[model samples]
Target: MNKQAPQNSVRLPERMRHLAVDSRGYPVIATINRSPEKVDFGSISERRKLALGTFDWCAVCGMPFADELRWQMVFEEGALPAALSGEAPVHEVCALYAAQVCPFLFSPRSRLSDEGRKGEVRESVVRFVGFESTSAVIPHASELQPGIHTLAFEQRGHADEFSYSSPDELGERFADALAREKPLPVSDAEAVLVRLFNRLDDEGEGDVVTGAALAAGAVFAKDIFKVQGLGAFQGKSYPTAAALLLKGTEEQILKFSHDSQDEAFSAIGPWVLERAGRFPLALQRWRTRGNSMVKNLGPSSPQGPGRSVAKNAPCPCGSKRKARRCHPAGVQATP
Candidate 1:
């Protein structure tokens, strides 16, 4: 389900993702192959503006990320799928046509009411695909950060998608989706997510994004470092890697309903607290500049647990055993 910002929620901020072609932060105007209609100046609209969906895969075609053949730009070299929306990579044709039709490209705005959604406001992501020599965009938002205004898919090759619909045909599909509607079939994972989302609503915590973020925090604090290949991040950007892991795990966790929302929240709550406790200043800075409504969602304040958990204290995960016995080996209480 799409995340919705309430009618009175603070307005989201925005920034333009100007292409910095070289080391000098100068703007470069790159071009995608334009459609005949676009080239002939035959299209005009006074209707509301449109933008791409919030997705990791191609906004036009629903393809999952499996190989480099499918180009999705990511900020950090080792970012997770969940964090790819900041760059929402797509097919070259899709990118070119989308840029032509999207109103966001010419002028970026901080908040737009989702075309047909009554009360939800979302920031736009202006993506530029096909630029080569990939690297992280500087001063960009991390996975946990909100108000991301750009997803740069600079330089890329294409997947062996031997078939594709005509641009006119695909254009209709994109327009429909951009207008708060979908013609695509719902997948099992998404269905399960909706079921769990209903559970969240019943608990008066209806926002899917908030639930997902808190759940992600749980995964980040405990299990991320344990991933077999995560050590690679220690040399470059641990925060980016941690953000990627957290969002990726959140996607996996949200695929089904839990026995209860309390079960759901408790499952992830302790770890969220632990992360805040461990890095108050870093988290605070993320909160200050990174975009989100979840800033005030879970904890009233991100204070440490205030004291060490006794070796005899019950585990934060609510397992019926002492912390030392239940948690992974050498895990210490959050500072």
Candidate 2:
């Protein structure tokens, strides 16, 4: 008897266009088995898993990974074993899309339909870990698994806890996930500077002396300081409060410019002018004290702004060896 494939009415992502959709319009991933008119979403096809690991194919889109980093979605408890077992890795976009749309992954109320697995609870957080692909054989698994050699990065997000009864709620969750992953546009330097400055302020550092503060300062120097003009800051003196702010800002700009002359340039005039309207009294004391205040601010560190840790010194991560050799050698664990 010839059986017809289920009609796919779902609007799938571009990468998942070639995937076969189940009767419910959910795209069946590459690892799912669909044979003899039966589709088992709860189980993985060992053959397909083997092939995916061997050929470096995405488990969701079944396409070859064009980039060096491969991603895997891991539940809280299964993270360690999943990494060790060499489970199939998917493209980051594919993993993110599946995280939002897959019922068992996205919905707290959706239980596993497989027999004896119906009682499993959904985890509150889903972690996506990216690593370079390294094929290895495991004791429990018969075929080779897509083992991880070095972890590049990891991201965590809230898993949907509410039982969503409508497509609208699901779409909202999908949009939220997409928004979280989107990077800030480079043209919006003001917004980036605001965020970085806010973080620096929260750290309670009057100057960029701490390692954390220096890191943040380096970003501000590279992104915001080098491009903007500072012609409007014509104040002879700034108020005490404004003078303090200017001191820290000027120090960061000068220190960063000294460290990387080609990458960053000192421009305090524009920064002060931009804030002058909002903080009218900030520069009132600057005319009398600005030059002396800047001179007194001093350097952030003995080595300089960006070079907090020496290349030969131990990394802050607590690894015993030198930073340049030890830092790049291991997998970054999931938090």
Candidate 3:
């Protein structure tokens, strides 16, 4: 599925990544990025190349790219380990694994060439350096404008000002409004998730969701996607929060529970593709995977939001009978 960019900016020459697992329980084929030009739904190709392996980094332990067998296996096709695939993006299964298995994955480097380290720091440390380009993005959890959202941030000095909405207009303003400064060096993004969760939990006003759990949920969701042949839905569609919750199993849902905390999320990634049902792109993939990638992830798995749950055998309502058998009266044959 292919979606158009924001109305303000022209579509960037982006790549499409289709992440999935093969037969073995390893994080292979992180994703397959299709050409942005491919827009048609039914005409899109089913087979494409893959990007495999977790992008793990560690200060003490180096990457294990030395083993030829591992290198070969990295590109190989297979299923992600059950633990890794619990509830994250299908493509990020390898990235989460890299955080655990590889010492050099996604970790900050203390020592480096000035330019190299600076570049790395810039990415990890995002200062709210004002708006680069204001365009509305589909509100993730907030109930607001659906059109282009502003892409404003704090100055270079503070990286913590990255907000989903325009912070300037909000009543709560930053200390030095529009200040420019370097952002703090962050080791792992999991901390961001932790902070988000903590803040939500602290509000104590509503359903509190932790940052770590969210990140882990995203990670785990992706894993489930890989196993379920739903990798094509990752970024192609814009799904709503409710729609995003449709993919995964009872165990995966438990993994992202509020109480799971940092420990459970230590090996998880963000489940950005949860909204596959909210948009047209993801919806198309949901329909295609049932026939194309069913062998790898299984059609029974909950891979999309709008998917007919009743068609999935063994109804969630606890009928103790296949959905089709118990509700054959409602099942409609596809012409």
Candidate 4:
């Protein structure tokens, strides 16, 4: 009888083991070293060069950084698939922080009564505390670093000293950061940028008018705040992107949302539209200014409004014909 071969696992790359498979069955070839193929995510160029789903990919948050960052699973208590047993999966990073703060988010809180939920003051209070505590601990958090808190929270495990921050805390931090940064209203921002570009242009700065800037300006005009583009018309002038920041019920901004209760929609959507409107306005202004500037130059050779042709007269340039025949296309002969 012939001896049968084992079919199950296969060896992968440098020192890393892998199971090989075929139509019949997968078999292990042998354990091998993990591949020496090193990848870097820091460089955007490198990230672009990478193929999709090449490295550790997260379904929820997308790719996790190779170096220090780790992925953690976060799921609502009841959200776990029936097939899954204990807890919903999450990245390790999220798991660590979730472990520290807002433990309720990980496993569902089943105890709260309907009346308690209706009140739900405790949850809000806890979140507020979390935000204040985090801000107190982390200067950067209090400062409201843009995406830094998220980034830091993601990479906290890598560092020696790091604190857990709740999502609310993160939001507050971001808001504070925005406050500190004091981003000009979207309309004002574009104007500032445009002004900067002009100053740079006057002083022989680098290419200020760029495809990206134009695209960005167009997006600002259409989406966020209505700031006119570098060259735009006045008929198109509209409000600043700040209109999107209007914090009120849809009832308040009647012109904004289709529904009165749609608060989120009312807040940001109009701002985007405002920005979009501005792009055309800016372009129109540019054209108008350009025309005026061009007109400032001296006039060209003067000429009559084609008054030379006389009624009943032969054409001056002789086509050797009567006035009627030669200059039929020209002015009628004088009576």
lDDT of each: 0.30, 0.40, 0.24, 0.25
Stretches of candidate 1 exceeding 4 Å from the true structure: 1-55, 59-87, 96-100, 103-187, 190-207, 210-214, 217-257, 260-335
Each model's total of backbone clashes? 7, 15, 60, 63
Give the Å shift of residue 247 in candidate 1.
14
Cα-based TM-score, every candidate = 0.26, 0.37, 0.18, 0.16
lDDT of 2 by residue, 136-163 (tens): 3221312222331211112222222222
Candidate 1 local lDDT, 1-335, one digit each (tens)? 01121212211111112121222221111211112122211111100000111112233332222222334433233223323233334544444344444333322342444343435332333433232222221123334325332222222332222212222334443344345322333345433332333231222222332233223331232232222222222333334322432332343333222323544333333333334433222233343333332222122222122334666677665676776677634333321
What value does the lDDT take at residue 225 in candidate 3? 29
Question: How big is the RMSD of model 4?
Answer: 23.7
Against the hidden true structure, what lDDT does model 3 obtain?
Answer: 0.24
Which ten contiguous residues of candidate 2 have the minimum total lDDT? 222-231
Q: Which order, best to worst by lDDT?
A: 2, 1, 4, 3
Question: Candidate 3 vs candidate 4: which has greater TM-score?
Answer: 3
**Residue-wise lDDT of candidate 4 within 1-335, one digit each (tens)?**
00122212211112111222223332111111111132111111111111101112211112222222233232223222212111112233333333333233322331333332443332322211110000000011212223221111111122221222333334343333334332123243333333322221221211222222222222222221121122232223222212222222333333544442333233233433454333322333322333332322222232122445454555554654554566554533311
For TM-score, the strongest prediction is 2
Q: Superposing all C-alpha atoms, what RMSD in Å does each candidate have to the true structure?
A: 18.2, 22.6, 21.9, 23.7
Candidate 3: lDDT of 132?
Answer: 18
How does candidate 2 fare on TM-score? 0.37
